[model samples]
Target: MRLRSLLFAPGDRPERFEKALASGADAVILDLEDSVAPLNKPKARENVHEFVLHHAGETALLIRINPLTSPEFEDDLAALSGLHPFAIVLPKAEGAASVLKLAGSLASAIPILPIATETPSAIFEIGSYRDVSTSLCGLTWGAEDLPAAMGATTARRTDGRYTPPYELARSLTLFAAHAAAVPAIDTVYPDFRDLNGLRAYVGRARRDGFSGQMAIHPSQVEVINHAFTPDASEIAWAEKVAAAFAARPDAGVIQLDGRMLDLPHLKLAIRILDVAGR
Candidate 1:
């Protein structure tokens, strides 16, 4: 699946659901966490339930349910049990045990995409996700909740880079996803009005091995998609590397341009070509 952009829409506002689906995002996540007020969770859960029932198989849709620690989590799961969305986005997930428990409760093969970083302890347990890799749709992180949990004033520095602690969280999320063999989706850019900044953010994310980015607005979708997609230059480079490897099938090493290329570089070239469907 092409998950270059996963857009989020508030679950309580069903009016925006169809519009989000039409926004050209690879996935539309109906979010019931943080965005919806405490009093509004029940209504939001129902909205998500009905929306999934009508549109489950039509698109790559997922539900961002309340955290397992939240009171509404069970209700959220029960509401969607009849016919689950393509995947479930479990927020504030600390480790593999919570994911496995959810899978056991659902008793289905539907994938789970965990927001792998949200609490202080979550930082230590990032690597444990490898145990539940089979049911994982992707592994992503969030910065907003972590600062609140840690009593930090902000998660970002003055220059917009994440603060040191959150930076560590981001790195662990990236590593965990790769270790689990799933897409590493970066957190939302949060500034929908700044297209140039958004572009730079997604560019950095793709370069760092993150395969997708979460979008808060439709305006961010195109930029996210373009940034993650291997461009013509990248495609050409990947093709050249692949062809070089093909010609020297029996050789264990090769040289490309002025650099030494070997098994790892060849593997990366193949992955790039595969992502481009080339």
Candidate 2:
């Protein structure tokens, strides 16, 4: 799957499910955790179950279940029985242990995308994701939940940039995903109305090696997709680097455009080509 943009839709709002899929996100996350009220969770799960039954494999569909510690987690699994989403999005995931816990609970083996840094303890366990990387589709983190768990006032500064601690969380998630050889998915940009700000955010994310980003609103989907997609210049450069290495198969280092390039450059070029679907 491309996974350039994964939009979240409330599981209870089945009316908007089709709308979300039509919004051009690579995937739609049917959220049964934070978005649905406690009293509405059962109904939400039913809605998600019904939707998944009809629409499974129609698109990249991910269902964000409640945390492993929550009582609703079992019900979430129960509702998803005999159904397969593209992946299961696990919130407040601590590490490999959490991934294994969810994996063991499921009747079938399903890919997981864990929200890796929602609690203070999760930060220390970031590196542990490499152990259960095979069970994951990607790694993502949230700034909003971590601050609330820490009793903080906010995760970001007045300028809408992440504070130092939250920045650490984001960086850890990014590096951990790379360490596991999985795509690092950036968390949702909360200010859905700020298109310019979202564009800048996507630039920083792409620069920092996040292959994709989460979207809370439909308007952000096109922006994320356009920004994350490799442009003509990038594709040309990557092709040149790839062709240079291809010609000198035995050479670990080669000259490309008068600059010395190495195996890492070739690997990156291959990744670019893969992302571009070339």
Candidate 3:
């Protein structure tokens, strides 16, 4: 449940699955969707199914299946019928309706982790996701597919920051996940070689309240995990806040580090501790 970094590996390559699983990611997602070409989808699904059936992982194991709109959707579901993954990642998910419809094809109650923003119309459908919160493992979004769907050249500006529209979409995804009471997982950073950039990117994500981030490469695992994990200062502050609340259970507000601390602040401190797995 502590999803600091969810790493993705193409399902077609069974050889790389073990490597990815051992990459120290909080979770490993075997991707059967965009990563697999149309001609390779069947083999990829087989590889994923076989791998899931035979292997045991310390971290969560997930499969990213093609969208409901894809002709391969049902086939993808069929491969997972007898096997249980930690969760299934549904790409190009618009809203609860589409996800719920896809649920009929699945054989188990395995949690769903959907990429909620893909199409132009999907932007308006986030509100409906709140209804399916209990069924969700987390809510994530991707920048690549959405822009492609809109016929845009890129989701980012020349400076490597998200453009206004993509930024809004990212914020909406974050808000929707929190409003739905699920973890807000940020999308992957394309520049895997740029560890400094990955650190800054994931640091910003944590600052903005995203619970976790996705990684497309193994080298990113350490940086993503470190970025999301609570450091010494954060843990120490949370400890003090918790102690303050414990000392004055009936107090409506308290002072900490020369600042006013309220119930909300106490709650956040507790969350930091919880997230840190203390």
Candidate 4:
């Protein structure tokens, strides 16, 4: 369940399926929307079905199906019936209602991961995800589609940082995920070749409480995994904080390293340890 990196592969490309599984990502998302052309969707669906049959239980394999509003949505669901995937990645999701709708369409109940922000209305519905969060594995956002929907030239500034509006979308998605008690996955860094830039991007995402990031390319997987994994120094600090609180079991506050350690600090320490798999 360590979703530090979810790598995407086109659904029609059965040849690359094994390669994506070998890329060291925590999960692989076989995409049926946006990546594959309309005419190729049937073949892609068959490819996904066959791939899942062969490797369903081996790793965390998810399918990014067409949006609920798309004409192809029902066919996507029909094609995936009777098969189990780690989760379904719902793109262009408006809110909890959308999650429930997809859940109802599935032959069996499976966890969902929604790209919560892709359209203008979707931004306003971010907070509604808490309603169906228990059924979600994570919540992610996208920068590309939203800008296109709004007719904006770009989502990012010349510096590669998101513009104000898109930054709002990103922040809302992060908060919504936490509010719903699910992992907040950062969107992909489209320029996959820019390792240095991707590193900096992952740092900011991790610093802001995002638990994972999407990887569009195999090379980005390593960087995402490394950035999200709790390091030795962090683990040590969490252990020390936890030990201090454990010794003062009844105390709401304790002094440690000339600082006042309180309940919130202990909570954060516990979370850090959990993330470190202690």
Query: Which number leads on lDDT?
Result: 4
Each model's lDDT comes to: 0.91, 0.94, 0.90, 0.95
Q: Please provide TM-scores, in order, for all candidate models, with all chains considered together.
A: 0.97, 0.97, 0.97, 0.98
Winner of 2 and 4 under TM-score: 4
Please list all clashing residue pairs in model 1, or write none if there are none.
none
Candidate 2 structure quality by residue, lDDT tens digits, 1-278: 78899999999899999999999999999999998999999999999999999999787999999999998888998999989899999999999999999999999999999999999999999999999999999999999899998899998889889999999999999999999999999999999999999999999999999999999999999999999999999999999898888888999988777899999888889999999999
Tens digits of lDDT, candidate 3, 1-278 = 79989999999888999899889998999999888899999999889989898873456899999888888988988889788888999888889987798776777788899898888888999888999988899999999988998899999988789999999999999999999999999999999999988888999999999989999999999999998899999999999999998999999899988999999999999999998878
Residue 13 lDDT (model 1): 92
CA shift of 116, model 3, Å: 0.7
lDDT score for residue 222 of model 2:
98
Cα RMSD for predicted model 2: 1.0
Tell how far residue 176 is off in model 4, in angstroms.
0.7
Better model by lDDT, 2 or 3? 2
Where model 1 places Cα greater than 4 Å from the true spot, the runs are none
Candidate 1 accuracy as TM-score: 0.97
- Candidate 3 displacement at residue 135 in angstroms: 0.8
Can you write out model 1's per-residue Cα lDDT over 18-53, one digit (the tens) per residue?
999999999999999888998898899889888999
| Each candidate structure's count of clashing pairs | 0, 0, 0, 0
Candidate 4 Cα deviation (angstroms), residue 18: 0.3
Best by TM-score: 4
Candidates, ranked, lDDT? 4, 2, 1, 3
